[model samples]
Target chain A: MGETVIALAGNPNVGKSTVFNGLTGMKQHTGNWAGKTVANASGHFKSGKRSYTLVDIPGTYSLTAHSPEEEIARNFICFDKPDGVVVVCDATCLERNMNLVLQTLEITENVVVCINLMDEAKKKGIDINLALISERLGVPVVGTHARKKKSLAALVDAIDGLPHGKEVCRTDYPREIEEAVKIIEKKIPEDCEVSRRWLALRLLDGDLSFKSEIFEREGKALNHLQIRRAVSEAKMYLDKSGIPAENVGKIIASRLVEKAHEICDGAVTGETGYYKTDRRIDKIMTGRITAFPVMLLMLAAIFWLTVKGANYPSQLLSDFLFGLQDDLSGILTKLNAPSWLHDCIVFGVYRVLAWVISVMLPPMAIFFPLFTLLEDSGFLPRIAYNLDRPFSLCNACGKQALTMCMGFGCNAVGVTGCRIIDSPRERLLAVLTNSLVPCNGKFPTLILLISIFFAGSLFSSLTSALILTAVIVMGVLATFFATKLLSETLLKGKSSSFILELPPYRRPQLAKTLVRSVFDRTLFVLGRAAAVAAPAGLVIWLAANITVGGATLLQHCSDFLDPFAKLMGLDGVILTAFILGFPANEIVLPIILMAYGAMGTLPDLGSTAEIGTALAANGWTKATAVCVILFSLMHFPCSTTLITVKKETGSLKYTLVAAILPTLMGIIACVIAAEVMRVTGFC
Target chain B: MNEYISLNQIKKGEAVTAVRVSGSSSTVRRLTDMGLVENSIIECVGRSPTGDPAAYLISGAVIAIRSADAQNIKVRRRENG
Candidate 1:
């Protein structure tokens, strides 16, 4: 009677979110699933005076409770009980995608199968008989190119007709399993939401979640111990019949595969030309010897392009903003504004915003578009495939590598990307360790230090860029090592199985990639950094000016942290600025500038010599520079990351570990660097 | 015979059944969540591009499985008749 609840379910990378966006526009909040941080995205749409709430369930392959996403998806479908469910499947990968459809069919009869990416499937010469699939599944099947908004009207019509439709009856498993299912069905309580046949098969497979949920729902009517006994009995019976309970589900799947193969054999006919091309590409991309080098070269090129291409725009933006600031300041002075008010407005707020825009925006605008191009071209998943092994050594799922890759853009997005890692333990491990991968926020610090201290006279910019790349590599290595250490010690467990599909490379739509990247990533970074930087600007202003005794608040804080900073091969000012810049890493350099009376703008490092002179004035030795690099590389994450960690792990203990682990590592690494420098007399 | 047994133990080129996933619902859901259903035939395809653990082809999808996780998975060899 109210808003129609339309549940959107799909296999990963089927462009379900694209459809949600197409329908609901950009008004969506990407947050943790109800209780977990596995990224539940929901939005609303109104079609023909009937408002609809679209819930995007995590893309899962099946309804097996082997991973958290599956469990959440299963619970939402079976319990939360939406008005209708739209199962979006990749038309190109129909057979594989149908596994989820088959599983969903067993659960609820109210389903609309939206075969997405029809255009891509057509490009591949794969012709799907949507009517046949619809008739076979016994549900309304709508073939759609979600990106093009094809057949959207039909999809809506199907959803509207869901309430009055007759129950769709699809084929069942072999008679033996069906017989066993019937027996188990009789045992199950009628009020249980899931189908008895599905429950029976699950029980035989030793699905504890299904059994637990049944017991919880049935209460005293079905004892927990009794349910366990019944499940055990089902397993034993299946085993004695020469079919292991575990193998039962697989047998059914293989049978379905055989049927699907038969259907495709006649329903679709295509040349092997495309398949050959796929093999040829896979040969080089996924090859044993060539893959790693190729991946590194690709990453290096990406970073090089980002840095080289961004330089002009970054300088242009900086010059423009600062030039405006000068004009505004002159206007304020002419208007007889008070000195403090003028300083706070011009030097404080305006300066900080300029730094964020100049330093953060250009790289983001360049990097995000490049990253999105790779993602759309289907190269990103290959990156995951390439990195999965190193990731596995750390007792983490390979998908964490993808999340870590996302971390390069922003850690919040990276943490959210942990949805790809299905295991809660592994996902948590990924989320907690993701901050070790330096985000864009930390890029300016790394870039500034490298440009100022490390790059020599000749090929200075090139050397600085290389140093930044090396720092990123170090951060990634640390993430892997930390994940491995944590998995082995504190969270000792097996990493869950992750099947990452390398989708076929498509031509990335330039316009769409640019628009989405600008809106989604560039603006997101600016908005978040601006929110934190505004108050941070005021705070830094107050700290620099507010004097305790003869020294300012900034001096007092630095002096307080001086002893610890000295031991860690850094000065008090660096540590104090890091602490103050916790809200946003974009302001750390500004805070440092404010401390040194440089008016909190990019210090005029016109030449390498000038940068050297500035460092000399700031009491930074070569050893101090090395320590700053290491500390920045290993330090505790910014406040945003800390809050994300708290939200994802949902335990003060894990959050503490996440924070303390990185902090301790940073201190220890810095101290070690200081000692090495002292002993070697590098200082 | 030893190759089969060792393969049964834990190594690349061995076939294994996903006996049970022993991690949290999040972990299990991720695997099963992605359609790696119980009883799906999983074959170790090759080592990762970095060559630590191995990758496997499961249910028409390629999944990377670490040695540590692989060791926990119990498999019964498909008898050659």
Candidate 2:
């Protein structure tokens, strides 16, 4: 009555989220699913006089409750009772997509089949007769190019017209199954709202969820014992007919496939011959001997481009911004402005912005676009394929490796990506171990430490990059080891089988990749860092300038945290900054600068050696630097990650574990590093 | 002869039927969800470019079950093969 509730459901990478964002603009959280962290999304839109709420259900292949996403999707549709459901399907893969559509039809028939990416289908020379599909399915089927909003108006009109539409005749399953379903229909209680045919099919397939649900709904009158007896009777009858429960599903699927093929026989046509390019390329890319090397080379190229291309721009931006700050300070002094205003503007705002732009922005700008390019090119799936075995060896889902790889970009995003792991236990394992992968934020700390200490005497800046790469490799190794250890111990479970579809390599749309990377990832990071950095800058300025008992506020806080920091192989200042940096990692460096500034003035990045000198002056040794870097790499996630974890798990206990586990690991690693250094006299 | 067939050794187009699932619950659930059951038909789609394990098409979805997981799952070659 108030607003139309429209649920969007589809398989992964079917552009459901893209469709949601296209409809709602850039005002939606495109993270993991709410509560379950299963990649569910919901957004709102207004069309004409009616407001519509679109719930993006997790992308699932079927409604058989194979994974958490599938279960959540099935439950939401059945229980939540939405007004209308939009089932988005891939236009190019209609046969496979119809499996889900047919399953949805078995449930409530208040549905619209939206065949999206018609343009891609067209490019592949595949044509669809929407009329025939509608006729076969007995539902409204709208063909759309969701990315371009093509036929979006038609979709809106369809939604509005749903209430007035006639009851379309639904498709029928096999006659034998249909007959069995009819008999079962009469046995089910009249008050049960779910379609009898659907329940019959589920029962025939031995679907545990349906059996449990029916048992629970029936309560004491039909207990589990009775339910099990009934199921066994049904199984006996089914087996006597020479058809097993599992065979029923296969028969149904194959029948649907046959129908889909019949409908598509003449409706669609494509090039009969395979492309030489695909074969030629696949020969090398999928080659047994060359694949690993090629993958490594490709990854190295991407990282090299990111690091090399980012340096000059990063330096330039820092100089320009910091120079503007000095000019603004002089102008304010000339205007006889208050010292507080000067400190807030110059030291607080400018310094923080400088650090953000100089450190966070450039790498992100270079990295995200390249990452997007690889993703668009369909290369990331190969990375998952490559790492699958190693992951399986650790008794974890192969998809966990993919999630960890994503964490190298951002932990929150990585944690969100764990939705791909179908098993609840494996998904949780992936989420917990994600923090072990150092993100872009941690890269700056790694680079600085490695550059100053490890690569200072022996090699050039290139060697510094290599050392940084080695650190990343180490972090990945840690992630694998941690995942293995956790899967074998704390969260013991069998790993889920994941089918990583290595999509055909295509030329990535540079424009789309660039825009999305810049807007979605780069700007998102910049905006969050800037928001926290400004206030943090102000706080740090006040702490530094406002001294208490001849000791700054920072010093007091650091002194308080000193004992714990020492035990963990770090000093008070470093530990205090890490604590304060819980909100955003970009703020950690700025906070450290402020802490040092409280003690004595330090020069900017113009003279790199000056920063090293200042650190040495402040009693920081190579051992301390190494400890700080390791701690930064392994420490608890920022506020964003914690919030994501809470949202994903929907349990304070799980969120606390996600937070504390990493922090504990970080502390232990730092302690070991410090003690080893101390005993070896490396400091 | 009870010759073992690891998933890694499965060639493209080879058909096998699952006899049992011998993995952890998570792995078992995942495999079962992928339509792997006591008697599900599976055809090896292809090997990874590196060939450590093969990709198989089962129940319409493509899954890369590792050699270890595959070794645990006993399979009899389809009679047609």
Best by the DockQ measure: 2
Candidate 1 chain A weakest ten by summed lDDT:
A28-37
- Docking quality tier of candidate 1? acceptable
How well does candidate 2 score on lDDT at residue A183? 56
Off by over 4 Å in 1: A27-38, A151-153, A187-204, A213-265, A271-274, A330-337, A456-460, A493-499, A598-613, A678-683, B1-47, B50-81
Clashing pairs in 2: A33-A39, A33-A40, A286-B49, A494-B27
Docking class of 2: acceptable
lDDT of each: 0.70, 0.71
Please provide, for model 2 over A268-337, each residue's C-alpha lDDT reduced to its tens digit, 9 standing for 90 to 100.
5663222345446655666678777786667666766766777677778877877887788899999999
Q: Pick the candidate with the highest lDDT.
A: 2
